[model samples]
Target: MKRAWKVSELARAEIRHGCSSNPRSLTHFLFTLKKSANHGSVRDLNVDADTHSSSSSSFDSSALFSNISRLFTAKSPTTLSETLTEDLAQEVAQLRDALARNLHDSDEVVRVLEENCGPLLRRFAGGSAIVHLLKQLDSRPSLALEGINELISVRWLLGSSFSFYQPKDFNYACKVLNWRRKQEDCEFPMTEEEYAKGIALAGKVEKVGLAIELFSEAANKQLRTTSTYNALMTAYMFNGYAHKCESLFWALKRDPNCSPTIATYNILILVFGRLLLLDHMKLTFKEIENLNLSPNLSTYNALITGYIRAWMWDDMERTFQLMKEGPAKPSTSTYLLMLRGFAHSGNLEKMEQMYELVKDYMTQKHNPLIRTMICAYCKSSGKERIKKIEELMRHIPEEDYRPWLNVLLIRVYAEEDWIEAMEKSIDEAFERKTTVQAIGVMRSITTTYFRSKAVDRLATFIKRAESAGWRICRSLYHCKMILYASEKRLEEMESVLNEMENSNLSQSKRTLWILYKSYLSCGQRNRAAQVIGLMCKHGYEIPMTVLPS
Candidate 1:
């Protein structure tokens, strides 16, 4: 009778014999390892002679363990604990390979690895591997942070000295949550920096409500610092709550613990600029000086941006002169903003001058600058537009040249109504998998095609965009339905709805309204009534004017 082999031995045997190539087989072995690791011992693994005979090519369990033990042959005599550690280390390397391969069930594999492999991880996995695992869980930041807490728990239970000292590891933790440990476990306190990073992460993921909750919690905990307040205010300002940002700024001023920084004033200026509160923006700039805070590059840029937004050419130029004289030198962003302002102001002379200045400061990585230059020329007249665009095109890096050229050509061709040229440019962008995020420009092109009743062209363009995974705006579908309704092509009209549904686009009040209007305009009162029913089903309040008798 064959002696009973250990679970780890069987796992190594299977992996060594091609089971690792099968994702399910790999997941099973990992699961087994996790179970055994958690139980503090490998279960006795047995294999029958018949099973072994069925796969004559397979290595026996003993042979696999023998190969692994040879790795430690040159070292001192190993104890059972050292042997277990070696086995756990090998499991970690396998986990890394499994993740790196990105199997179909890799996400599920990641969840299992995090939830079940804590002991093995604490024994063998280093900080970098933990960080990699966290990033692999990037789609779920909450879960990523929980993995860290799990490792911490395992460390405490094992009485191991595992610590996260790397900046990247700590920063990622902060981004997800303001985590703290008990007083006895080398406590990490709730801090303003932690709150700031957490809030920024929330904002980045568009979880503004969560950001607010974090800020409120910070206030309740009396962890309100200048950086924390600044971060929250920025989230508010960028998410179209500029008024809330202004109110927060005043509250920050009143709070004795939170002294406003230059960043705070910079955010305030931007808020005022966006709100068109030019007087308030200027007062804030003046207040910065009164507070004896030396204006930084960001301060001047914000002020200039405010001037540019309000179309105050004289003031923008004056501020630019001041920025040039002050300690804060202009950055590439300053010149790019100036270029846009000048182009819109129709001061091509000044635009060209700024373009030269921009080129001197800009690098190949400044693809946005190149796009802006092309857009600026598009707003101008004459062949010089093409000449300048081509000139700027030469400076774009080889890697970025194609995509940038596609966007630039789209803009130029769209402006000139070169339909074939525009379509070709768009096709190239999609083919290269660099679908342009120029939704507004695409809307304009689609609207042009729709208005002209170019149904074939419009359908082709929409199909191409959808195939390339670009989100088709709802308005485009509605407009198509309207066009089909006008033409009395009821079949195509309803097909638009089907397309929207198939794409997982939810029906909205506007969608129902469009359908109701379409059916009613087509003299199909019964279909119109069905749409009103859909509206009711969707919980949209029907307008009295659209109600059927």
Candidate 2:
């Protein structure tokens, strides 16, 4: 009692024509063929020999003849079997089977088509569809070029450019598009807006070279604007290209069309600060005054930061005083810079004074001023001051405490030989996962232990740091080598040196110098000579005293 179904003649005719005209339509034709083959009327075509013969005898000859006549009419006077040649019929059968197996496997279908009918699939399928398929497959760039060309042909310039994620792919697409434009006598000129967007994108991705090139292009085409120049200058400054940044600054200044703004001078001052060019920074500030341009709070902050970096406490205080007198009020950053300077110089009294002065003006909840006070107290040698600092630390919220501040505590305890307190501070630092500060504290503690000849404590602490998962960095290794050299443990020092060489980390000039001195102290003359050679090879100028006579 199976139900019987059939494909209508019109439907059959449409499938036939679609299949012959477009190979991509073969899949649809195969679906229809599957439905037709399932009908009871066509079951005899796939029956056993006994059922086939019996069914063939009772088969509806009239319907079969009508189908044959219709196929001939549709296919220009050819018989059905003749029109679908034996080879074509066999291929269709295989395709139907493959299609049925790969119904849900798009990748398998793509692979089959690519391997067996690549050219035919490309010819019949639309470019967008092929592009989508290729993207799904993550195919090579060459294969994607066809779709890129299609998009360019239809003037989808942005779409074509953005479809590629790889730099080379995007560049290739652009190059092809530009070539096409040239052939068509059309210019592919980027407008100011487009150039700006490209530069912004390049900057966002940290491709400084690309941003610089885009800026250069804009300049060559006279499309450079103030925003573009500022963006390029910012990129230069951030990438540590001070020479190029200064050159561009002067170039922009000479360009009468694009005038510099307050932000421009601020950036220049920041560049000088970063390079520690205090004199140039002062000159730039003087020029600002000469131009009658009023200096803002940021301008003063930059000057104060520069002076702080140079450790010029006198100049920093003078600038800070001038800032208070000027129209611009002191910001939290200005206060923090003063506190840090005082802490660095171990001036606890001045640090306390600045903290009291700026405590009211601190707008943010996370003030670095408190941390600076802790550092100053830790650096001081007075027990009463340390006691006071401990009381102050209790008042601050636990959540606001930074791990580096614990390093200062460790230093203080190490100086006093307070082994229990130092151990507790180290445990707390470990819990905070302050890798950088922990390394710093380790170096400081190692130096202190070396001076005190507390060799056992030093070794135990190093083992503890390793257990805490802190990888010994180059500086820490240098400290170890120095300690070992002082103890005349030449073999241990050599082992440390070997560890440093095996590590991927590059040693700084100072680290190399320390290693050289350690080898010389051990009386390993040949090894010391090799250390000097390495220093010279890495462009570290060797001092004459370090060089053997």
* Count of backbone clashes, every candidate in sequence: 0, 0
lDDT of 1 by residue, 279-398 (tens): 999999999889887676667766766776577889988988998898877655567667756755668788888878755545443444455556567667766676677787677655
Residue by residue across 110-147, what tens digits does model 2's lDDT show?
A: 45544533342223221122222221222122322223
User: In model 1, which range of ten residues has the least summed lDDT?
Assistant: 26-35
Residue ranges of candidate 2 with Cα displaced over 4 Å: 1-205, 213-223, 357-372, 387-407, 414-420, 426-549
Q: Candidate 2 at residue 252, lDDT?
A: 73
The CA lDDT of each predicted structure is: 0.56, 0.53
Residue pairs clashing in model 1 are none
> Worst ten-residue run, lDDT, model 2?
26-35
Q: For model 1, what is the alpha-carbon lDDT of residue 175?
A: 25
**TM-score quality measure for candidate 2:** 0.43
